[model samples]
Target: MPAAALKPKPSNEPLPTQSTAKRPVPLDTPYAPVAKRPLPPGRPREWYVTHNRRLKAMRLAIALLDSGVHQPDQARDETIRSAARLIGVHPPSETTCHMVRALMRYAR
Candidate 1:
């Protein structure tokens, strides 16, 4: 709502009603350009690897879900890799593929 359309409430007036409450506004655009931000410093090497693996697994799992692959058993490495490709992520490692299946199993 435009600020100019609002009227000042008198001191004796009751609190604003639900009709005046804020509504969720839709975004003007859905696509966001990726930002290039550096990772936080001082993390252990193992931590970085695990963090990256988790992110890859999450993206792959969501893609599989969107493509109607729900069960962990149905998400074999080849299937997971194909999902990765469909989503434009690099082909994941065996460990990352295992993580993807683990994510699917945990979803329920």
Candidate 2:
């Protein structure tokens, strides 16, 4: 390795200064997180699949809206998937993307 490579780069971060008193965060009523309650036992397989897909579509729609995509026309598959990753959910399937668009269409 060249001698130049041995030198450490300076950090862009400023040296820590004594923090001032933090202002109280404004209270905004945000959406509540999913309830911890488990799904009831013994549902049919297809019921669960449709149920989960509905949930995923709803989440993706909300994420897209939050990211300023207000119209169904603006919600392409890739756009919905990007929103999925942003909200920390699994990427939605093609069908779920369709459902998200449907939800957005209905909401307008």
Candidate 3:
């Protein structure tokens, strides 16, 4: 027998793929975080008030849905009112109603 034939056979399996083909990023390049643009002078207060209201309503809806107290229904006004009361929001604003509806969709 020849020497090559006596030797072990080469592997038929392919080599593992790598993710290192991309070039390394330059260390000297500026990489500062994106700066937030300032809001218009008189709009900040109202913007924040509205934003906070929406956030509060979302939180309330999540809590109500998680508690399993209010089952999902397409025409359930009482559920929305209960959720509004749970979050201490009076009059159940449009934002609160929207959040409640969104929560119901997920719950169902």
Candidate 4:
């Protein structure tokens, strides 16, 4: 093979100038002033506990559904409810159950 054939093709584009180059924003730089919104009111301890429980249940349900150990249709509701109970979600609320079911359906 000829040495000329090994040479890289040259680009037609002009090199970028300092004015055209994009520089990273400095850490000390202040961004545009964003409107500050008041924080929402906090919930009760029970609410937090319930919320955590629901999240745990949702995560567990997704894992179980993805495991493929069970059919998507057969005994799905019962399985989710049982998983929730095992995960210390107590008697899972209707909303929690519904959310779990929806997640299972969507995942499949």
**Which candidate gets the maximum TM-score versus the true structure?**
2
lDDT by residue for model 4 (15-83), tens: 675353354434333223335565346878787777666675566565455444344455355666666
Cα lDDT tens digits for candidate 1, 1-108? 988679775574445664533554333333233465788999999998998899879988977886789999999999999877776778999999999999999996
Residues 10-98, model 2: lDDT tens digits: 87555568343353432233445677667778999899899989988998887778678999999999999988777678888899999
Residue 6 in model 4: lDDT:
100
Candidate 3 per-residue lDDT, tens place, 1-108, comes to 889989998775545774543635443343343345654566668787777676666655665654565655532566667655655556466666776677666766
Query: How far in Å is the alpha carbon of 64 misplaced in model 2?
Result: 0.7
Best-first order by TM-score: 2, 1, 3, 4
The list of candidate 2 runs beyond 4 A from truth reads: 1-33
**Model 2: number of backbone collisions:** 0
Candidate with the greatest lDDT versus the true structure = 2
Give the TM-score (vs. native) of candidate 1: 0.67
Model 4: residue 65 alpha-carbon error in angstroms: 2.4
Name the weakest run of 10 consecutive residues (lDDT summed) in model 3. 25-34
**Relative to the true structure, how large is the alpha-carbon lDDT of every model?**
0.81, 0.83, 0.60, 0.57
Q: Rank the candidates by lDDT, best first.
A: 2, 1, 3, 4
The CA-based lDDT of model 1 is what?
Answer: 0.81
- Segments in model 4 whose C-alpha atoms lie over 4 Å from true places: 1-54, 66-72
